[model samples]
Target: MLEQGDQIGFLIVSGTFLTAMMGTFIVAMVVLHRQRQVQNRQKIDNLKSEYEKTLLNIENEIQQETLTQVGRELHDNIGQLLSLAKLNLNSAKPEKQAEGKEFINQIIKEVRALSKTLNLDWVEEISMDDFIRQQLHRIESTGYCQTLFDSDQSFNELSKDSKLVMIRVIQECLNNAIKHASPDQIQIKIYKEDSLRKIDIIDNGRGFDTSIQSRGSGMTNLKKRMETIGGSILLSSVPGKGTHITLSLAF
Candidate 1:
């Protein structure tokens, strides 16, 4: 019904309107994409901040524990040794003086060993497996319980942060078993399953109900720390049987 020129003009107007609508849609999409990107970046930054804070806390705790051990050694071990050395050196006999020198040399060696633990550098030098074994040996030396360590001997390299957190968690578990569970035997097993490296701390002690909320924040704090390192912890316990804690980290 319209003339050719009129139809052409209508088409031109319709085309212009459609073009404007499409331009607005494209701009909206781009803005939305950018906004989402910003939000994601913020979330990542927040997580990273939390992780760094956790590492700092772990480092401080490790240093504190090291200091405590050093203090005890100074008072109980090294102080006693120094007193003996002084007694020997004050003696008139040459053999007694030689014994004093030997004691001094032994003291120097021990002091050097303890100094290594004063810094976080030792965390990098020690492997997780070695640390676990040392902890078990220490516990066994206490004569409170027997300890068994089984490993697949597979090498799984972890970041220093991960190793530190894992060490702290393992220490807590062992301490809890000793202080609360009163287990006769404690066992640690390390192995790889699929893509995950796993450590299992098992104690044949009276266990608590996992369903009940714990009055202490220890377990919750551990779970949060594991989350920061992208790891997981699974706890299983029965009232009379024992407690099994499985810690897993993906490599």
Candidate 2:
């Protein structure tokens, strides 16, 4: 019933309406997409902040542990050396002077070594392999277990954040082995495979079945810490045999 002009007018109006709707829809989509992107970025920032805070807490705990160990060394080892040196010097015997001097020099050396552990600055300067070896050596010196470290190459190529996470994981693994596993020997091996860096901690201890539930928080914490660093951990154990923990990180 409409004339030619009316049809053309109707078509133009319909076309304009559709074009406006499409333009509005596209603007809405863009806004929504931008909002989602902002939210995702905020989430990432929050996660990063949490990771940094946790890492800081770990560093503080490590520092306290180091200080405690330093105190023990001072009280038990260096103190005894100094006392012996003083007693030798007090005798006033010319022949014993050399022995007293040597003891004093030894005490000085021990003090210097302990001083380095008073702070965590050295951690930044040392390679991961060296750090692991140092930790194992501390355990070995306790006479509770025989510890060994083997590495295919140094892990200094890793980022500082990665190293911090790795250190915490290794420490936790070592402590767990020493405390619960009751292992006579503990060994750590570090190597690179393809684009991944792997660390294995093996202990010859009475291991528990993986199927069983554990009441301890150590394993849970270990898993969480590894996850924060974008790494993965695998645990294997056999009753009456031993336990092995492998930590893998992409380089």
For lDDT, the strongest prediction is 1
Model 1 C-alpha lDDT per residue in residues 1-251, reported as the tens digit of each score: 46988999999999999999999999999999999999999999999999999999989998999999999999999999999999999999999999999999999998999889889999889988899889999999989899999998553477788888998889888989998898999999999999988899999999999999999999888898989999999999999999999988887
Query: For residue 141, what is the lDDT in candidate 2?
Result: 93
What ranges in model 2 sit over 4 Å off? none
RMSD of each: 1.6, 2.1
226 Cα displacement, candidate 1 (Å):
1.3
Q: In model 1, what is the error at residue 120, expressed in angstroms?
A: 1.2
Candidate 2 similarity to native, TM-score: 0.90
lDDT by residue (201-229, candidate 2, tens digit) is 99999999999999888788888888888
Clash totals, every prediction: 0, 0
